[model samples]
Target: MSKVVLITGGSSGIGKSIGEFLTEKGFKVYGTSRSPERYTSSKFPILKLDVKVVSTISDCVQSLLEQEDRIDVLINNAGVGITGPLEEIPLEEMKSHFDTNFFGPLEVIKAVLPQMRKQHSGLIINVTSIAGYMGLPYRGIYSASKGALELVTEAYRMELKSFNIQMTNVAPGDFATNIASGRFHAPVNENSPYKTAYGNTLKLMDSHVDSGKDPKIMAEAIFKIISTKNPNVHYKVGEFMQKFSVALKRILPDKMYEKLLLNHYKL
Candidate 1:
């Protein structure tokens, strides 16, 4: 029997690209969307799932396991973005952001871990972002959420090693996707101190994503990662500069890195 792969947020964007790519490679692929009816794929079946809802996550995994017997790979690619000034952003909005981006993936991991542990072998790939490594102007909450997920991926690697279950955090810098359009923007205070700066930086961030690399590149990278017997704990995907900037941040002085981010976003 072919190895089974389950991907969340597979209705479109990077998740859909990866699901289709893996299916073409002969894996039994299952993809999930809030409304499966909106996405039709003959090669891989779509299941209804909303990462924010624990019941939907449990039901989705249960249904998949009943038919496939095992899930060889679980990709936590379902997430949402929130942007605005942190100080002015409402607490509820931040909670909602974390619900989808951080807790959502955590809940899915919980739902699938039992099956993976039972098999004594499986891979969990959490799709993080380059933003996870640093807090960006006007996108601090989104950064914080991804950053939290990245930390969990590290801890999981150590904890699951004894069980022979593997985990990887795939951090993509930017990809051409509808994420920008779908992102939730907190209500901005007109008189906030950083209002003008926030708006300009937000615009720059959107443009950056608009010109990001194709999602196919990320899909190809993920496929290669899956084929490897022992992949790295983390993989960074993006253009030369985007990936390089991550490296630079590590080596640069704190103030220098902050300046680079400010200049990049025109803040």
Candidate 2:
């Protein structure tokens, strides 16, 4: 039988690309959306799921299990983006961002674990961001949330090893997607102290996404990882410099790396 795969936030963007690619490769793929009805034309089925809601996560997993009888792979790709100065972004918004980006994926993983354990084999891939490796000026909240997930996956890999389940993080750099449109942006208030700097950084961030590499790059990387017998704990997909930046952070002094970021954002 072909492997059964579940992807969260698969209605569009990177998740959609992965689902479609896997489907063409003969994997039985299912994708989730907060509004499934909106994606009538998707190549794979779009189940209704809101990662922030435990009940929806449970229902979606149950529904898929009922149909496929097994979930060989779970892609925790459902996440939202938030960009703003740390102080200026509302506290509630920050919490909400965590709910979707961090807690949501955790809940989905929890919902699927029992079944995966019963099968004695499974793979869980958490879709994180390149920004997760370090704090970016305006996208601090996004960095924190994704970064937290990256760490959690490391712990999960050890715990799940005996059960024959594998967990890994795939952090993608900026990809050409609709993420910018959906991201929560704190209004650029003219009188706010961070108005000018925040405004410039925000524009630069969107431009990067606009000119980002194709989503298929992520799809290919994911496919390779899935086929590997002993996958690494973390994999990054993006432009050479974007991936190199992570290495630079490891080798550079704290102040030097900070300076590079400041210069890049022109802060």
Candidate 3:
């Protein structure tokens, strides 16, 4: 039987690319969106799900189970991007970001665990960010949320090992997608101290997304990971420099790595 896969936020961007790719590879793919009605023409079924809403998460899982009987893979791909000076970003917004990026994924995983455990086999892939590995000037909250998820996955992997269920994080660098338009940007206020730096950094971030690699690359990476018998705890997919930055952080002194970031952002 073909593997049954579920992907959150699969209506577009990286999720959509992965869903389409897997569909062509002969997997039974189901993607989720807040507004599934809008994606009637999607290659695979797009179920209604909003990660921030627990009820929707449960409903999506139950509905899929009724149709497919088993979920071989669960891709926690639903996340929103947020950027701003940490101090200027609203407290509520930070909480909301975490709710979507961290807590939301956790809820989805919980919903699927019973079935995965019953089957005595499954894989859960958390789509994290390369940015999660470091705290960039204007993207600290976004970094923290994803970073928290990364650590949580590390812990979950150990707990699930005996059940033959696998959990891993796939951190991607900037990928050409509609993420920039959907991302939250705390406005740059003229009177605020961070206005100049925040504005410049925000522009740079958008440019990176605009020129990023094709999302198909992420899809291919996902496909390869699913085929592996023993997947690593973490996998990164991105440009050389982006992946190198993580390696550099591991070897460089604290202040020196900080300096590199400051120079890159021209702050």
Candidate 4:
């Protein structure tokens, strides 16, 4: 039997692309969406799932296991983007981003881990962003959320190693997707101190995303990660500049890195 794979946020974007790619490769792929009825794809089945809701995540996984006795892989790919001055963004709004981007994936991880433990082998991939490596102006909340998830993945890698379950955090740089339409744009009123700066930075961010790498590259990376016996702890899918920026942040002086980032955004 083919390995069973479950992916969250599979109705569109990177999630959908990965699901299709895996399906084409002969894996039995199951993708999730809160509203699966809205989208359709051949070779992969869409299941109903809302990552933020623990009960829904449990139900989805249970349903999958009922149909197929094992879940060989769990891909936590559901996430949202939020942008604006962190201070100006409402606390509730920031919570909403975390609910989807951080906590949501955690719940899904918890849901599938029991089955993985029983199987004594499984792969879990968390779809984080390069922004997680460094805080970007106007995208502070989004960065925080992805950053949090990356940390969780790192911890889980060690915690679950005894169970033979592997965890990998895949950080993609700006990707060509409809994330702009779904992102939460925090309020930036005239009185806000970072109003102009937020606008300029947001514009630059959008431009970068518009010209970002294709999603297929990420899907291929994921496929390889799953196929390998011992995949690296972290994998980045994007242009050299974005991936290199992560290394740069680690080695460069704090002020120097900040200066380079500010210069890139023209801030």
Question: Best-fitting candidate, measured by lDDT?
Answer: 3
The whole-model lDDT of each prediction reads: 0.90, 0.96, 0.97, 0.90
Candidate 1 residues 1-267, lDDT tens each? Answer: 688999999878999899889988898989999999876644589998999999999999999999988999999999888889888888998998899999999999999999999999999999999989988888899999999999999998999999989999999988899999899886556878987888887788789889988999989999999999998988999988888888898999999999998888877
lDDT of 2 by residue, 203-252 (tens): 99999999999999999999998999989999999999999999999999
What TM-score does candidate 1 get on C-alpha atoms?
Answer: 0.97
For each of the candidates, give the backbone clash count.
0, 0, 0, 0
lDDT of 3 by residue, 124-218 (tens): 99999999999989999999999999999999999999999999999999999999988889999999999999999999999999999999999
- Residue 193, model 2: lDDT of 97
Q: After superposition, how far is residue 48 of candidate 1 from its true place, in Å?
A: 1.3
Can you give the TM-score per candidate against the true fold? Answer: 0.97, 0.99, 0.99, 0.97
Pick by TM-score: 3 or 4, better one: 3
lDDT, candidate 4, at 44: 82
Give model 2's TM-score versus the native structure: 0.99
Q: Model 2 residue 176 lDDT?
A: 99
Q: Candidate 3: which pairs clash? A: none
What stretches of model 2 exceed 4 Å from their correct place? none
In model 1, pairs of residues that clash are none
